[model samples]
Target: MAVRKIEHVGVMVSNMEASIAFYRDVLGLELQGTIGHPDEAIKLAFMGAPGANETQVELVEGYNGGLPAEGKVHHIAFTVDDLESEIARIEKLGVTFIDPAITTLPNGARYRFFYGPDGEWLELFEPPAK
Candidate 1:
């Protein structure tokens, strides 16, 4: 009953540094910080936009990296202003696209899927302009 919005989405990564780079450099998220879990075997990294606290992305390392048949988390989608340009830019950075082409919804929203450092699916979503 207290849930208002998604606080964060946790993703498992094999290599924490690589995952951090992909999310920070490629996706442009700022590294909030990193901490070692109480268990000591697990390490975690938190990232989000520069000034916005909205939804944060948590990268978990030393967890089960062996994702199911689907993928790490099906895919973590980030909202973008210009889907086309963002796709092109990410593609230029050598990220492979899972979607053959951008998909447009009935409401005019557009989205595309790409891969993350750990073969995890990632998406860029563009909502219809108001």
Candidate 2:
């Protein structure tokens, strides 16, 4: 059976309010809604792109169990037409970023990673060269 596109990417964060503010105010993502799961002891929010596209970032809060550095997802990269401008906009949010966009493969795609709300790693990538 063929697989469809990704529905969402779930991330566990310590703080939900801070995460929501960053994604909504800083990153400019549209806030869909947040639901609290008492059984799971967690709260989640889904953010949509400007075009009403699929939920890109799934903000999960109250996961006090913590995550391991190894065997854990490193970061999430969102594609953009102008990587530099996006980087600048995100920087204004007061988060630190690992920069110096580089090219490794022959295709030479540039990318950079920045900190999201609650210090979650987030990436921004430029479109592949055509």
Which candidate wins on TM-score? Answer: 1
What lDDT is reached at residue 4 by model 2? 28
Model 2 lDDT per residue over 61-102, tens place: 765436875523445766666767776776687768765553
Q: What is the C-alpha lDDT of each candidate?
A: 0.75, 0.64
TM-score of each: 0.53, 0.47
| Predicted structure with the largest lDDT when compared to the true one | 1
- Estimate candidate 1's RMSD in Å: 13.2
Q: Where in model 1 is the C-alpha error above 4 Å?
A: 74-130
Q: Give one digit per residue, the lDDT tens place, for model 1 in 7-116.
A: 45678788889999999899999998775554467886889999987788878787676777555654566777777888778778999888799877555667677889
For model 2, the superposed segments whose C-alpha errors exceed 4 Å read 38-40, 68-130
